[model samples]
Every structure is written in C-alpha cells, then in structure tokens.
Target: MTGNAFTAVIDDTMTAPNIGEPEEDMFRLARHLGLDIQGFHTFGDAAEFPQLQREAWDAARTALDRGLPVFAKELDLGNETSLIYAYDADGYYTHSWHGGKGHEGSDAVIPWTELGRNYCPCSSCRARASSGDRPSDGVYTGDPGYGGFVSLHWASAAEPSDARRALGAALDFALSFSRRGAYGWGGRTFYSGPAAYGKWIGLLRSNAIQSFYMGYFIDLFHESRLYAYRFLLEASEHFDGRPGDELRTAAEHYGVIAKNFQSLNKLFPWMQPHAPIDDPDRRREAVELLTGIRQLEEEGWGLLERLLTWVR
Candidate 1:
C-alpha cells in the first residue's frame, strides 16, 4: 500500500530559473527526468477556487495513493514550486524551498482551503500505472548534463559558422537583461538577468533586502557564472591557434568569476527573503563583493566581444 507520503530531493535548477523563464526550465527538467507530465492547469476567483481545489485535491490524492508526489506552484509562497506528498481530511503535506516557517525540506501542513486560495495550476506526474509497477529510481536521477557540455559538443562538431552562431546566441542570452525594466509573464513582474542583480545590489547597499533574497541572488549568479565558464571552456575548444589561445584565456577568467560567486554564496548561509542582515560591516562587505563581481562580468563581456570579432 502507498504510505502516508513520499518526498524526493528537489533540484534547485528545476525550481529556480537562474536563466530563462521558470516554466521553460521546469518542462526541460520534467522531460529530462522522463516524467509523463499531465501539463499545467490554473484556477482563479473564489467561485472557481472550490472547484479547482476539488480537482487539485483529487489529483493529489490519486497520485499519492499510487505512491507519487505532485508539483504545485504559488502556494502563498514565492511562486517557486512545491511538492505535495500526502493529504488527509484537513489538508495536504508539502515540501518546498520555503517549506513554511523556515522549515525547508521538512513537511509543512497546508489546509485545503488555504491551498485553494493561493494555488495556481501546476503539473502532476505518475508512475507506470499501466504496468502496475513503480517508476524507476532513475526517474529522479536523470542527468541534466555537465553545464550543457552536450550542446557544446554538438556545436563543436558543426561548421565554424555554426559554432559562431551558437556563441552569438549564448552572448545574446547572457546580455538579455543587462538594463533595468519590468519583465514578466502574463503581466506579473519578476526581476531577471542583470536587472535582477542590480535590484538586489541596490537593496543590499540600502540594507533593505532580506537574507533569503540575498541567498537567492547568490545561488542564481553562482550558477550563472558556472554555466558561463563551462560555455567558454567549450567554445575555446572549437577554435585553433591564436584565437583558440585567446578563448582559453577568457575561459580561465570566467572560471575565476565562477569561483568568486561560490565564495560569495558562503557568506550568506540562509535562504529567506525576510531574514535580516543588520550589521553595517557585513552589508559593506556584501557591497564590495558585488562590486568585484560586476567588474569581473564587465571584463567577461569585453573578452566575449573580442572573441566575437575573431569568429565573425
């Protein structure tokens, strides 16, 4: 029989889109994990909330009954994804990044009514019900690749023009949000790219940002720099002679930036937006670290520009 609940490790990349839209990464992760996604659904307004709640409840119960967990979004929390693992007469048990009450990774109770009020339509998954067998453990362990190295390999094998185009696309993606402005989906504003970084830096300098948001930015840029380093490394392999040497040097610089981001993340251990950073000394230290990071990123942009001239 299915137990009271099931919980699995949530991949941060799956829940947080450090780059691109959240759902883009979510769907990519689901597919990479071989999940048979039943697609996402939404419910709004008080009248529709009850009906949607019933549908969601039934969906959660059905999946849990079969020993599978469901993905839920917008649970009065940061629009991040949460896993619904079990349900009973009163409410559902969930695990999320902010698992309510500073209890990330632990089960948190949410009354059905409360869930209904804050719920947005989300994807649900199941095992091989047709075969009456549970899904493979590998389902939860699918490889997402080593920093997109697979794409790098494919780009390398293509023509030089093709590789140049790929690099151009990568550069465009890197600079997508360097300037500040409102960006979002369906008219809901969400900070993104360099703008997101700028906003966080502004808040941090003013001592108005929470520790959680600080941690979030640290994780975001850490991952971003890591990916940038990997892409540059792979791009370096495609060139030859002087150009190749230059690319390798640029890759090395990005690697340093990536390591710096890792160090920055260590400064803030918690991941709560409302968690305070009241010490003036600590705030100054954070500002200095961010300034250094921005400087390194500017250097990276300059290096990339030089590389593009050679490739084009």
Candidate 2:
C-alpha cells in the first residue's frame, strides 16, 4: 500500500531547517504539492560539518522547485517498510482524516518495507529489543538526536530466521493501522465503513483474480462440492470443535457465494472512486454500480441462505 503520508515537525518549534538531507526531500515535495512546511533543526560545528546536510538540503530544494512534495528517509531502521514524509511549505497541514485538527505531517510507510526485510537486519528493532524492555509499538517516534518531533517507522520485522512469523506479525500490525483509514495500496483508495469493503470487491474484479480461480461454473461447483464434503465431515467430526475451523471448506463455500455474486463485485470497480475510475462521472457511475450490487446482494444472500440450509 502507499501507506500513510504526512508532514511532521521535529519539535514544538522545529521547522524544515533542522531536517537533514534525507528529510529535506520530504520538505521539497511538500512545497511541490503546495503543502505547508514548517520545522527546525539545530546545526553547528560538529565533525560531520555542514557539507553533508547542506548538499542534501540543496538537492531537496531543487526537487521542491520541481514540485515533488514527498521523499523517503535515507535512514536504515530495522523495519519491513520504507519511511517517507511530506512537507507543507506553508507549514499549515490539513487532512480529511483528522477532521481539521490539521497535521504537522507524518511519515509515509511504504510497501517496500516488506521487500527490504527480505535482505537486511533491522537495526532499530535490535537496539530496542536488546534493551531488555518490551518496545512500544514498532513505531519509532522522535529520537533525542533529532529532538522531539522526528518520528521514525521501523520497517516491519521480517528476518530470514523467522521471516514467516515476523511477516505475519507485521502484516497484522499494518492491517490494524491500515483499517483505521491510514493506508492505501495498488491504486486502491480505502476508507471507513463499507467503503473499504466495496473497494475490496472492486479490486477482486478489476484485478481478474476471479478469472484465475472462480470463472467457470463447473470449477465453482467442484469447489463447492469438495467444501460440502469437508464441511459435512467437519460438522460430523467437529474438528477442533470449532465453527468454520475448516478454512479450506469455509473458503470454498464463501468462494462459491462470491462467484455466484460475481456480477455484484464486478460492477463496482468501474463505478467506485477508489479504482482507476477517475473520470468526472464518478458519482453517477458509482450510483449505477451500487444499484447492481444491491440487486446481486439480495439475490446472493438468498442463495447463501438456501445453501446454508442444505449444507447443514
């Protein structure tokens, strides 16, 4: 997902100046995107001198002139995602999410983190974990070196040794925050309520994922047949004594329902505002699409009811 992108201050009074080269890129983009950029950093005669920071800042300003208001942080933190931030040249932040409380700006958690974890060891996590204290959420906020407002997002934990477990945990974390209306990916815009649910439906259709698995009537029937047998066995034996513990069965059952309702999911991708459906006619198209889904849902639910009665 594109993750959440925002502009953050290093502190109460900090503005863009205190940000190093890497951070300057975010500032530059904010300027390009016509966002407010206000932040400060302390710089003086240290061994690193002003050259490195100056070069980075200068380059960032150039990008700002070009109007690209987002940039990734160059720091290496041990997380599964890349960190990016945005700057508002005016330093005045406004986001639909906060309901006008205004944003100081925040970091962008890129999907690339998952990719990055495939290679390196996450240093931030190591340091935090080594302290013999349970770390707060993976979120790294305001390092002392950068003063208070410079927050960092640790790439999720995905190491070779326990990559599977780490990936699962990280995905869970991402999903938790994402569902709060903080992330978007694969050209899909997700929001609250049925908006996200509707987006998933559209995504399933436009991506042609169903064509690969749920296209043919026979294939769906076979799947349902297999699931029915399994479901019956589960019901009879009560594996783990759980309802729907047999995911293979439940998925197949749901998959059948989803396919039978394919037309419902299919209509939205073309109508919803989330997908590549960016024409000015968005609302009208969506309304028509919603009509179709409504019809299909009514019909689909009926089918589900019948199927449920017969299966059990």
Candidate 3:
C-alpha cells in the first residue's frame, strides 16, 4: 500500500518511462514507506559487462540464499520483469512470464555471463518479439556490452513509513507533478505530467498514434489510476475528519480518472495493441476522453494541493 501511484509517468512515445523512471520519485515512495532498495542498474558497456555480471551474481546469490526473493528487469522476454528465485553453477534461476510459456521454472537458468543481456536467446522468442508490436524487445546480438540490467532487492525501512506521513508527501507529489513544464526530462525525447497528456492527444488527433505504445499507455494509465483510487480510499480511512474527507474526495477524482482510461481503453476497442484503429468515430471519442482526463486531473491537483497542507 505504498503511494507509488503518485509517481505515474508517461513519455512522448507512450512507453519506457512508466512508473519506473524519474528515479528519485521512486526513492521517495520507498523512503516514506520505510523500505530500503538494494542493488544496482547499469548500462552494459563492453568493458563493464563482466563487472556488472559479477556484481549482480553476488547480490542475487546473497538474497536468494536467505530465502528472500530477487527481482530483475527484462530477465527474459524483453520488458517483462521477473523473479530471480534460485541459482546453480550454470546461471541464475528465474520465474517470469516465460516459465508459463514452456521454459518451466528454475530450469530456465540465465547464465551469469548473460545477466544483463537485453534480448532473448531463444530463437522463437527472438523471432516473435522482433516481429511483434512490442517495442520493448531489444535485439540480442549476443553482445553483453549492448545489454542493460536492473537488479533489485529490498531491505528493512531506514525509518518509519507512516501512512499518515506518506499521505502528505504523496499529495505534495501529485500537486507538483501535475504542473506543466515543471519537471525536466534532461533533453530526452519525452514528456511528463499534464504536458504528457497534451502530447498524447495531439498525436492521436493527427492520426500519428503509435498503436502499440498507445495501447500501452492506455493500459498502464488505466491500471495505475485504479490503484490510485483504491489507495486513496484506503488512505482516507487511516485518518479522521477533514483530512479523511479530503482524501475521500481525492479518491473520487481518481475514480473518475480510472473510468476515463477505462473508456479510452474500450474506444480503442478490442484491447489488442497489434490491431490498428481505423474507425474515425472511435478516434474522436478517444480524444474527448483524453481531454476530459486532462481537465479532471487539473481538478485533482487542486484538491490534492489543498489536502497537502493539512495531511499531517
């Protein structure tokens, strides 16, 4: 029940930065929730590949041996985060989306040397992923240097993650993140906060929607706002009187936000990212939903900013 919903992020392409980038915000969410994140993330330069593998190997081994779970990004099937549960001499064992696809559990060990390899080694996975609409599928050219790895483990909170305290911080984040042109993307080709909505809408109206990533945006936003609605409802009950009332009202805003995305998801009908949306009516409807969401979120920012002053 951490307040990460406050950190929802979207980019110009409608993918890549969802909830995971803007790294400092994630650290903020973890901090207020009283947890410490351990491990490292690195781009695999050829010279650093061996060191990256060794570091990840050591960390994963330590965590897994203690019966604690280990997690990694893109362990198999590009863009699919997975669990690093156990290990053996050959490599680290994993249970990710691939296991269900016939790889089976620990048997699908990713050799330690390939720890951060971006693409899949399997011919079928490579073939399908490369040809599919999934932009996350990086080509595994068998070069360790070209890969990237995100290895993570959790440690006990350094301080108390009081929900009451975190609420104030969350509301503060919601207000700040909503302001247009406030956060910088370091010259990267991306957008954040309310400006992101405008970028997304402008693309759709111009019939320039990248169908796969557009579907990705809708789906991710839909799920995040649903959680925001639920988290606020839960957080409301944790406090009393005006603070609680404000939170409940905040929940209502997110509830509407969630429903907005729900409508957008449907209007882009059939929910299949691979399928192109050719119907002009559906496109117009999607634009309306996005515009409505932008307005609704503006209201939410106001409500949350007010709540921020009194949360503690």
The C-alpha TM-scores of every prediction are: 0.51, 0.22, 0.83
Model 1, span 102-214: residue lDDT tens = 33334545676554233222211122324443221111121212110000000001122356554554454334434323454422345543445465567777777667667
User: For model 2, what is the error of residue 19's alpha carbon versus the real structure, in angstroms, after optimal superposition?
Assistant: 25
lDDT for each residue of candidate 2 in 210-246, tens digit (9 for 90 to 100): 3222123223223433443343334434233332343
lDDT by residue for model 3 (1-312), tens: 334564446655544544335454555567776666666654565666678778878888887777665777656655456677788997776665553454324245677776655444444555655786342453232344454554445344478567777777766666565564434342335555677788888878877765677777788888888999998898888889999899899899999999988988876543455545577787788888899998887787777778887775
Error of 3 at 214 (Å): 2.6
The candidates, ranked best first by TM-score, are: 3, 1, 2
- The alpha-carbon deviation from the true structure for residue 245 of candidate 2, after best TM-score superposition, in angstroms, is 5.8
All candidates: CA RMSD in angstroms? 13.8, 20.5, 3.7
**For residue 310, what is the lDDT in candidate 3?**
78
Model 3 clash count equals 1
Judge candidate 1 against the unseen true structure and give its global Cα lDDT, from 0 to 1: 0.52
Error of 2 at 156 (Å): 8.0
lDDT of each: 0.52, 0.31, 0.66
